[model samples]
Target chain A: MTTSKQSAPISFERERPAGKSAARYILGRRLSRVWLYTLLIVTGLAFGLPFFWTISSSLKSITEIYIFPPTMWPAEIRWKNYADVFTIAPFARFIWNTVIVTLLAMLGQILSAAVVAFGFTRFRFPGRESLFVLVLSTIMLPWQVTIVPQFLLFRYLGWINTYWPLIIPSYFGGGAFYIFLLRQFFLTIPKDLDEAAKLDGASNFRIFWNIVLPLSKAALATVAIFSFIGHWNEFFAPLIYLNSTDKFTISIGLRYFVSNPFESDEPREAILMAASLITALPVLILFFVAQKYFVQGIVTTGLKG
Target chain B: MAAATGRSWWHSSAQRREALEGYLWISPWVIGFLLFALGPMIASLYLSFTEYKIGGSPVWLGLENYIRAFSQDKLFWPSLNRTAYFAIATVGLGTVGSLLAAILLNQNARGRNFFRALYYLPSLTPVVALAILWQWLLQPQVGFVNYALYQMGIDGPGWLTSRQWAVPSLILISLWAGIGGGRMIIFLAGLQGVPQELYESAELDGASTLQRFFNITLPMISPVILFNVILGVIGSFSVFALAYVATDGGPNYATYFFVLHLYYNAFSYFQMGYASALAWVFFLIIFILSFVQIKFSDRWVYYEFS
Candidate 1:
């Protein structure tokens, strides 16, 4: 992907020396190129600067953060801040809990959304259009609107403190967005293969499991990555559902250092930064690994479509 | 005889069998939608009319919570007003900025792909990490942003701390963190769809680049622009984590986005019924706004497929 764009012939090279006003054209083009490059650099910095600041602040001592003209780079890197983070909060437990939820959610979403998307895309389905629209409607409603009822339902089931509330929904068709995303990829598959499978007496489920699943690797990887990141960073659901401190995900646990009003300890900046970095690490790594798929999914699918 | 045959109400045939297979294939999602998604939505709607606190049975009170929110509650309107103000400002600036960035990055130039990935890195950064980082950067007294402003002989206002600036500060942060995906992706899609012939034709007519962009690219991409606008508004309205992490709704009651307000009401105040009403109202508002946008977009947006 990178090489194609990088190695592609520059669009400018073909546009040399026209019959009329060549000097004026070259001057105008030069001015435009300068302006475009200037715009690109400024915006690049705007987007990139926050990440630079995050890593810098994560390395700084708490006292140094509060110092005037905040050091762009710490004079001395304090790697012990990673140690401080765990001491200040239940960081390990949070990581374990987050890992479990993320894995479960990712697996569940892959199975359910893919199966459903296959049905919508591959099969001749009755009420397919209407049901697909119904599924799409779920994306339209914000999670905030459903919090109360979900809380009540979970409470009734005695699953509030358990990971069931977080993981089980994914098993039962997690996100409409993933379903729609997978559906797009599924549609691009040739229908002739399904017909051949039918001739071989392969059932729909068998075809879906054996053939469709293997072929849709990019889409599946994209779904897995997205679902993992979504579950990893989810704060509100965990905040509401998990009652026990030990059950809290990394996102909820990270709140203990700086924001928890109930804990009267002074805000530990170093620890908080460390915890934030730790919480973000898995997602960052996952994104880099499957970035091509992620980019493809976004370009093809609607925003949460 | 076959032509005159009357079909039974329940037809047992290959076509009917295929239909059944289709239903079977899709049953998992249907069951899930009914049980998990639709069930809760309906429950919330029902609960909005009934005063149901935790550990207490719901008492039927028709429109009581809605009435209280409108007539009695002081924070409700101001909080909503604040949220609306925040949404408009953030979506307005962020969409334009991100779209421009997408366009600039879309140009075939040196290091374009690297710049594309660079800009998207912030979006990939975990929301918690970015929020905490912004909290430090926006810290009034000794933060980098203010310190730099100080060096320039410009005194920066108390950002998250001041009621007047709290929402605006959040708007800026939201834009910074929120830029990578929606506008950029939509613009990428729009850019791909723009006809090369149009640009060639425009150049032949001695039209300048700016004129070509305005005349060709803008109109061609208007559908995508409208789509992003609708999604952006819906997203901006429901924003919670960034505001919750950064300000806890403020030094005063400033950055209390509607979702945060709903969260406090339901969780802290234990006003489940009231919160449910607020949630419904938000859904209604978003639906109406998006509906209006789509209605207006019909005239301007060019859908080539149509």
Candidate 2:
């Protein structure tokens, strides 16, 4: 523990000027920053090529999708494909259902995980450490192990083909990874803050409510973003639990374009691409908004393990 | 307000009362775990010993399901072997690729943030969509992947159809999608944790980039690597959606992973008891793998903050 801190300062001094010189050397030794930028731009294009291809193809007719040499751009952006996508199945309803489930699950995950994390980090109880480890252990238990029993259990409860099976678990802390993440973050805060609250005559609940909650905004935001993205992309649970077209999440509903064994008569490729891009839009938006906190949480949580 | 001074009305409550309140606060998780997790887990163990379909009560027939899976089922051992192969390949390729990308990204290169986001984008794509995209891209005749290979004068095999190549194709696609998700993120974090002074000392000592990486960077981030490996093993074995969406575990059942087999048994074959046996076996395999990793991790994983 002491070794890392002691060595850290020494290394900082030793590396400081050498790093500056190396940076200067790389810059001065380069062909051109423009060329470096060009390489970056090309790599960026390669990385983003799929998204562009998907979008451009979504705006094209089937003939254009298979056109020889592949059209890099669409001649005419077919807006009607969007309408056709919905007509093929209840695309609108799928979108609506996906949004509903994602929001509900995200909210449930954040609230439940945070409360449990708070209990683990702030409270002194006999089984707190043991319970925390149990939570962590669940992260390793493959969902496959639980799938059969869960299926039967759901069936016995008459919960099959309903959103209840999929959405209810989040409220009960179904995913343990997020709970572990929040617990580590909560532990990082100084204990004196809690002691100060106690000195001010604050009870444990009020201290947690007023002080801990406000202090953990970043961790909370990170949890919210992760939960939203996960639930948004989830397909398997919805596939198993929702039997009706009306209850289908967007992920499952998008499968309608492909008739399982073959492509449907409609614009399957275009419509599928459209649906994929549409589903990815919310996550992309959330990523941009919470980029800093998300990255921080990932790094810190990694260290905790 | 007087609680801090040990004078509040509620503060005088007996120790038993406080303990009761603690249980009350945690009651939701306790109830939920017993109902959803503990009950199902225990019931699945029992079901594995019996024979039950989805409709009827299980009839106790100890060891039959397990024995049948081991001796009679051709698909069981093959699926397990194939899954292990795929896990090794996926984790190997995914770790190397993501580690490279993360190392490059960690350099204070301009526009790094943009590239990082771009790299992470595909990981966020729904597995179904990504599978469909890969299906199109890997189609032997119509796929862009084969098309590219064709130009190189190498005819691509039927990626999704050929039993010989189907598992590899699934592994490659999954590796590509999963690379930036956990590995890249964690590796980037590990890079940050490595003190800059170590690099400077290595450079001062005339350690080349490769030497520095092997000696310093690897040791520093071994914990993260270990963590990613554990996650990868668990994830690779439980693969469902990708194979489900991509090949439907077919072209000869070559790509049928363990979970898919379990799904087919319970849902399609209507052999709930048999599926429960398979699930327990799969869980035990994962548990053993993770336990071994944790056991070995202490030898190599460096904890900077400890």
Span of 10 residues, lowest total lDDT, candidate 1 chain B: B1-10
The residue-by-residue lDDT of candidate 1 on B1-306, one tens digit each, is: 132332541265765676677677667788888777788788888889989898998889999989988889888898888888888987888788777777776655578767877777777666667788778778889776788799999999988888878877888888887777647766765665465667766678998857766777788777767768888898889888888888888777777778888999999988888889988888788889987987887788766655
lDDT of 1 by residue, A1-305 (tens): 00111111122223323433222222235446678788789888888876677677778776786777778899889888888777667789989999999899889988989878887886553456777888877777777778888888888898978999888889877578888888877877888998999999998888898889999887788788888888888888888888787888888787755666425555566567677888888877877676676666666564223
Instruction: Tell me the tens digit of each residue's lDDT in model 2 across A250-301.
Output: 8887775564433445436776677677767778788878777667666655
Top DockQ: which candidate number? 1
In angstroms, how far off is A284's CA in candidate 1? Answer: 1.8
Please give the lDDT score at residue B177 for candidate 1. 74
Misplaced by over 4 Å in model 2 are A1-46, A190-203, A260-267, B1-17, B304-306
**What's the TM for chain B in candidate 2?**
0.92
Candidate 1 Cα misplacement greater than 4 A, ranges: A1-31, A260-267, A303-305, B1-12
Residue A233, model 2, lDDT = 89
lDDT of 2 by residue, B1-306 (tens): 133543443445564466456666566667777877788889899999999976778899999999999999999998899889988999889898788677656554666777888888778888878887777767676566776687799888999889999998998788667766657877876666677677777777887656767788888878779888888888888888889888888988888887889888988898989999999999889989999988988888877667
